[model samples]
Target: MATSIFFFVLLFTTVLSRTTPDEASRTKTLDITSSIQKILNPFSVKTFNSFKQEENTVSSSSLLSFQLHSRVAVRGTSHKDYNSLTLARLQRDSTRVKSLQTKVDLVVQGIGKSDLKPMESEFQAEKIEGPIISGTSQGSGEYFSRIGVGHPPSQVYMVLDTGSDVNWIQCAPCADCYQQADPIFEPAASSSYSPLNCNTQQCKSLDVSECRNNTCLYEVSYGDGSYTVGDFVTESITFGGSSSVEKVAIGCGHNNEGLFVGAAGLLGLGGGKLSFPSQINATSFSYCLVDRDSDSTSTLEFNGKTSPDAVTAPLVRNSKLDTFYYLDLTGISVAGNAISVSPLAFKVSDNGDGGVIVDSGTAVTRLQTDVYNTLRDEFVKGTRHLTSTNGVALFDTCYNLKSMKSVEVPTVSFRFSNGKELPLPAKNYLIPVDSSGTFCFAFAPTSSSLSIIGNVQQQGTRVSFDLANSLIGFSPNKC
Candidate 1:
């Protein structure tokens, strides 16, 4: 009885020591005592429905806008419940990261030797088609946007990708197509649809193409073996009722397959000339993603809104892989203390072999192996007062908070070469991975030379890509 009492007293004293007034004030902390139900809400498949909310409140003449939906925030054909779907999503996220790394490797090796062109001689054996962005597809993109296609525009959901170039859709006469929520687009029904001739400049722009009865036929093969093949055509692509781009290049896919069963096709928001934003001649674009657990939808704007006081960072261009938006991430800090990783870990090599990119399609932030470990170790040390639990999925550090109503966690921030600091919200990093009140660190390590700052880290921040100025800006808490 005496021993038990003494042990209890010691434990109480230790806990109190960490929470004293002075110590608490010095530490940058986060309160995570909310209901487990709120934390697990995003994982529940049923939480999101099939309601098509009107994204644009004003005419597209002012700004081209579309509501962006996170993968789990949109109702789809999948029937998996919360736990199963959550696991599936994480597995798919891993697949997406691997494919991204593979694509980067291929791009660096192919273009590093020369200027901007991939080594066609090497890829001929693999039969890789499309541009440098044509590495692979796992249907692992994270966001969706509903858009109007063709003359009398038919509304369809398109997966948004900041890493791709060509805009494509699964058209009628699909020789093969996965299940989708919307009807397949029919070229015959649109008066504005025009197939490009094999001799056109647009046809010649594709990395690989074929001539079929004088028509331009294109094929894009992904790393996972998924592919889309059809005619390259021009159509009237509408944003809202008031604005439309005429003769926009689009891939009318007659045969398409892979994990993209929920959406009609993909909309490329990349930096290449063939990307949707580039095709439309937009100077810039911006988006503010809501929290994964929030029910609200955010808008993707073209030449539209942005915070006046957004901190800006110069957008670096990798001549080898110009399709991606590269950022010079200098360092990272936990609770205002910088990690011990070398700055070279985040640098883009002169040969374009290694670089950090801000990608909309990637879900979790990935860092160099050494950088990630240092950050994770520092975070763990800062939260030593919290109860530790087994890791979840790709996240190695986790906390069990089943008993606590709330707990304080260390704050994390990212620093850029321009001396701009992007301080993240607590919910963005310490994300709930399950209903058991288990929260995991959302960052992960990658052996690949490429590093990506994913959407999770960008949540609640207004991220703007200023192509004209060659800059990227971050406006915090603007979602």
Candidate 2:
């Protein structure tokens, strides 16, 4: 009990900074579907009018905000025909998407009141490495160079995604019809770039149509509604630094539609493509991120598995499954109390995509109906007697946020795929809403997925996505 209580206080620390209006909005919008719109409105000029047009755009906030409110939230995977403009990964995909959102909301609500400082500090390296890479395409505006350069080199801004398997970019002479990002990946001029023919081992792995010329074909959708379709290519990509990787199989998007601004391509970081490292003459994928350009040198860790000090936090390493980091959940806790959640079987559905996805791109954690309700109940029972928000129509959860107890926040711990349990800041998990009079923790009126572990929950935590080992690892740090 004492240990639990200690964690309770530790988790509640972020709330100390929540006195700002930003937090007030997050407290309300956490469970609501338009969280990113509400959270980033102050910073961005874009209206974020609809779900489909929202995902592909770069946010004034981090990429995290852009990923949270996707078209998927509005529709399910069944609507795949809708395109990013309509068929996006439905704010709820595979019961798992819902769980992820719920998890993020709960943690935000719980940790909004924590005592920790905002973890926006930075450290960078000259060259980026690993699966992280900058997106590139024909029309994608100006590419922000970490070390500069790539300008007019047919620079393509690529989408860095964890939810996909194919690493693809926009290409020229595509009959499929696509808006360019920054000039297409020119096959003729790119001395190092080459397409994979249908007969190769790589093309056969897609498991769908026959690999005609060693080219594996694929298409991917996002929650906010953006999609790309094209053939795979075996090419060489260079990072800003000295490292370069060759023969990396990537998708050359031949067809794309809807809200594809600057037409940047995608950086596939899921288990499958990211797991295989580049051979002798090439370096694998990597990135150098910094909130402020004036910040210190941001470091780069190859494969982030052995080296724990990759980011601000020590990464917890877990192996990859195909192309995803499957973080296992040993148990789910509410109100600082642990719950008996079955492995893979979400209380809401027999099919568990139940484990948490340590996505650095997602803004919140999506949770299952049962898990969300249990945690909400704990918040209602423990906090200022209620949680509420001003905008009731767009989002849910009840008012009484003022009276909500500031102390004893519930700590939500996740057991990683490697048998390690990691506890996140409680406020980073819950959301508040207001009704006619009573205030209660209410689930998003539209939520239907099991869970998604977003970037917010990953703050200060280093996540190691090891495709080779088939696991992901994370470690907490003082953000």
Candidate 3:
């Protein structure tokens, strides 16, 4: 499986680098037009044009709320080959999970060695670059949001990530760049794009920085081998359609390499100082992801109010892994039956490892090996009467739905330490593998100490991150 995974990675790398300029330009234009249509359909021509033309006059207070749909929904508009799409998505998701596991392992190792030496030195030796704004890799099946950057804002689509802290976009004068579905942003054209000098406070905030001819140079590498090296700059950023914030910190990536197909870069929503939420002074942000199959668009809003009926959980904060949103998962239940897993299994260790995190960049839920075994065994017992089938590479529990007229799937719930419980629907756990009646468990076991609640389990739910109060809220079917 590892060999096959690497093969796909090599193939994707070749394809990305071999794309002709004409092909890339054509795809870029088509994707931009498609994205515009998706976002503009709900408004009148007069209203849409007015918002774009009068963007500068829009006040910060008036621009407080904006919404964006998932990239998956946006891509569905242009996907002509549906038969191959599902398989491709699954393959990419598998690769993403593997990459996340590698990251968890690296974090654990770095923390364990912190007492012996500086963590920064250990990370550098491993080629694990610090946080810089880069796009979410394609296999994650994540969502993208449109944001306008620079003066006289140039609109660019970027992956919306809560696990990252730096906002970045592909910039012109690139040493090496990947082919994106949108036009690369030219910093020279924007009157407001000013590079930060190395001595400035903003440049000093970066985890990894270098002084290059007085300009601040930054580089960030992901666990999946995707990297972005660029200059740090401040510019205006517009969210949704009307809300614009001035003098925002962002990475103008001149050199980038990754599997970011449709996105020009990433919009980081993490809690760090460099994150979009922190920079914009947003009290809270919320998103409601629609079902994967639904053609209906979902919403990602900044400075959005929490629902009155939403359940709240205390967010765990680890200074060592500040870029991720951590949550304390006390227990899990299947069909009202409690699984006996130790609370310590979900706790972060003293070395700053082993904890449950809510990540928007991962496609499927990942659990520690022992916890997953217990859950999988219990699940198998509950559905023992059904005819089982051979497992997929990562998914061990697959059932042939053709043998039964109806499937009875148990409800799975996650109990948090804050007394809040999230009861997930069957679709969140049992995902369709193909056009045939084959369904597989969406949860996978990881060798690493960390666990993740991925976007699949977040479907049809409104997840709100209140950074000011350090609380996480969830309201089902609120989209």
Local error of candidate 1 at 445, Å? 0.5
For model 1, give the RMSD to the true fold.
8.0
Error of 3 at 168 (Å): 0.7
Instruction: List, residue by residue over 1-479, the lDDT tens digit for candidate 1.
Output: 99999999999999898778544443454455564555455545553365354434443424677777766577532533444555666776676777777767877676432243332321242353433222135335567777889879887878888887878899988777777767899999999999999899878777656777898877666656666778899998777655778999989987775657467888888887778988889988987777655556777888864568888888999877778899878888887777887868877887777889888877789998988999999999989999999987788999987777677777788888888877777777887776677888999999998999988889888899988888899988765
Each model's lDDT: 0.75, 0.40, 0.70
Error of 2 at 81 (Å): 30
Q: lDDT of model 1 at residue 91? A: 70
Stretches of candidate 2 above 4 Å error? Answer: 1-153, 176-181, 207-227, 261-263, 273-301, 305-321, 340-356, 360-362, 385-408, 415-420, 430-450, 466-471, 477-479
- Give me the displacement of residue 465 in model 1, in angstroms: 0.5
Q: Global CA lDDT of candidate 3, please?
A: 0.70
Residue 174, model 3: lDDT of: 81
Which lDDT tens digits does candidate 2 get at residues 1-479?
A: 99999888876875665545443322222233332223322222233223323213222322211122221222212321222211122222322243234333433344321322221112111121222111211111111221101222344444344544565666766645455424556666766666667677666554232243444555443333344556667776554333445677766666644344343465545545332332221122232322110112222234333235432212222221333344555455554356655565332222222344555344445566666666556555555533444533322455543332343434555544344456554434443221123232323322443355655455444455444444455545512
lDDT of 3 by residue, 1-479 (tens): 99999999999988878775424322111122222233332222221121222222322333454445554444543333332444556566666666656655666677332232222321242344433223344234357665678777787667777877888888998867787766789898999888899898777777676777898877666655677778889988876545678888888887776767557788888777898888888888888777555445556676767788988888898766677788878998876667999879999887677888888877778899999999988888777766788886678898877544456666678888987777777777877655455667789888888898988899889899888788889998888
TM agreement with the true structure for every prediction: 0.86, 0.56, 0.79
Clashes of 1: 2
RMSD in angstroms, all models? 8.0, 14.9, 16.3
**Candidate order by TM-score, highest to lowest?**
1, 3, 2
